[model samples]
Target: MDANDLRDLGWTSEGPDYRGSRFHVRYVAHIATHRQGGVANLVTDECRDTRYAERMLQEWARDALKHSGLSQAELARRLTAHLHRAIDRAAVNKMTLGKRAIAGDEMIAIEEITGFPAPLENADGLIKVPMLDSLVSAGNLSPREPVKPEDVDRYVAASGLPPGDWIALSVEGDSMDLVSPPGSVIFINRADTRLVEGGFYVVAIEGDHGTTYKRYRASPEHFAPYSTNRDHGPVIIDDAFRVVGRVYRTMLDIGPHASRRGK
Candidate 1:
């Protein structure tokens, strides 16, 4: 998760709760730097358009618990472990009802722990999602910000996509060409950040490297990428790395394939 993720979800950095807090400032600055240059598209308390029916994060959590059978405290504890930070039940409770915007990491942490799919797009049919100008490098080490270019815009529409905050990112490397070919546009759901073994994800490496699109397999200690290009290999899972979101579909100029054909 990065600044674009926060911005896409309506998180604001200029709220009163964030003011005068160095802790918030530092982390906000850290994530903001994930994008090398483009300005944020839109940073409002409410989403720019009314087509979306936001199933609030807290509401999503309550619904998720019906299946996971975990209490808020238990979920918070699991999240604390996942993020290696102290996050209590109160923090979780306050998030949906408070002024402080939820950070991208926690957004993902909640998704991973709940095992619940984020709410699908609440529209009737034929939805148009913005095509981000940025390309998510399909290779790992050569990180390029998947930050959307707001200067210019394009939109694409497709039917039958399993929805959840869907956005498109152009692909730039051959590492995952069997699925996401270079020059293709990958439609990913920012709300679906869970790391299912052998699942496709758009991931990021914090400092120098940017973002990559690949299939993820988890061992006890590392994130192994199943790449068509053998040169791109496994990455040790650490604070420096994060699964940005799952790649749900890919639109290659040659054709669009809904199912995974290779590892």
Candidate 2:
């Protein structure tokens, strides 16, 4: 349910339709932040009870339904039933537990009423997908963008290669220079080369755990992590090294510093 997963779900923030006027389950929590008073006040309380937030949202949904053209009595009955269901879903006991509250059923009821489902919930239910976070979120790279996905097969065929999963990470150190500098964004492809030879890549290793952005060299037995910096020596890879992925894109944004140097 991180930023990347949201992007992949076709949830764009740029459209007027996506503005606060629309009510999605996940968006409910976000939009609640800007509510005129009551809900916003509850959500903003540093030590506010979770049940309070749930109750406030349930009330808010009831109001929305009334505006949806339902009669007063019908709205009252429907909202009451939904609130009871939400209380059970949220696991709220008779006694208010304050800090231990979970969003529970009320949130789901809100979604059901609004007709927008949460991606994380769907991932757990029908999709059975993995928890995700990576480059597609940071705008570093994408599998398909201006080109529609149905047209991807044609694009891949024209390029003579299969489409790959892309990821991006910030370069932290100077080990990779000349090609990539500190703070550069590097895009990687895990499917590109499973077992890589000599090439720039993002290597994920355990034990001495780290994700290194470097030029990886594979030999008959052992491997080496080479650095473009002349002063830095190659990191010898033993059985301990594991390759997570490889670097496929690099963006250097030194801003005024790069300009000040006139490069």
Candidate 3:
């Protein structure tokens, strides 16, 4: 399915980050199926490699045709009749053999014709990032410390993240706005805690003001919000404040899906 179809099915795109531009359609579909106590019919591996997708498409097409008991000619005739597209036997052979790139519409047509799942349903190369129990505030700094690994209760399949100690934190408010809205999942590189330059970071203050997400600049130690919401002001990082982790990537929460925890 295309992005529009995924969105219609309550899936949202978490755009390109360190991994490249891959949609989280399989992940969302898994969540939807899980919530309904149904098995996810699509492949949900977090693979981003193009060659893998191509191979998967070819395999799925062959399997679909074999299971449907329809010969290439019959399938092509049916596709042309139902989709009003000139998909002949040769075109079907090329797609099933992985010679031609399958367009989104054609894939949809194939799924409709063969009663098969979407070919690109599996996530192949994504690593599951742990979601920490601790919450980071996007509105006001809350008094919470980063938790240990034992405190982690969930995992999120993500790509494009730099290799390092990483953890996922949920944004609690809209203080960061466009960059990270409320309920967004932010990935932090735990090993890169030392301040270097101006970028987003999760910081903890000594006193009542706890962890917060903000644009942090090192030359002049201070943290500020990118949001136009003036309720929050810039905070000067002093001896009492500590850098928790650098925010490298984020996944937007599109609906009521719980983070998948490690079993």
TM-score each candidate: 0.43, 0.34, 0.47
Provide C-alpha RMSD values for all models, in order. 21.2, 22.3, 22.2
The 10-residue segment with the lowest total lDDT in model 2: 152-161
- Summarize candidate 1's per-residue lDDT along 1-263 as a digit string, tens digits: 44455658776665334433344555655445544332333433236443123335445656776667887788889977765567888877665444234454465556557777544343224455666656443223232344344521344555577757766777766777777667777787777888898888887866555676767776665555555788877666665776667888887654233122222
Q: After superposition, how far is residue 215 of candidate 1 from its true place, in Å?
A: 1.6
Candidate 2 versus the native: TM-score?
0.34
Judge candidate 1 against the unseen true structure and give its global Cα lDDT, from 0 to 1: 0.60
lDDT of 3 by residue, 68-97 (tens): 889999999987765445789999899888
Candidate that would win on lDDT: 3
> Tens digits of per-residue lDDT for model 2 on 124-201?
121211112332222322324332332221100011123565444555556666777665655556556466566776
Q: Which regions of candidate 1 deviate over 4 angstroms? A: 1-124, 135-152, 255-263
Best by TM-score: 3
Better of 1 and 3 by lDDT: 3
Q: Rank the candidates by TM-score, best first.
A: 3, 1, 2
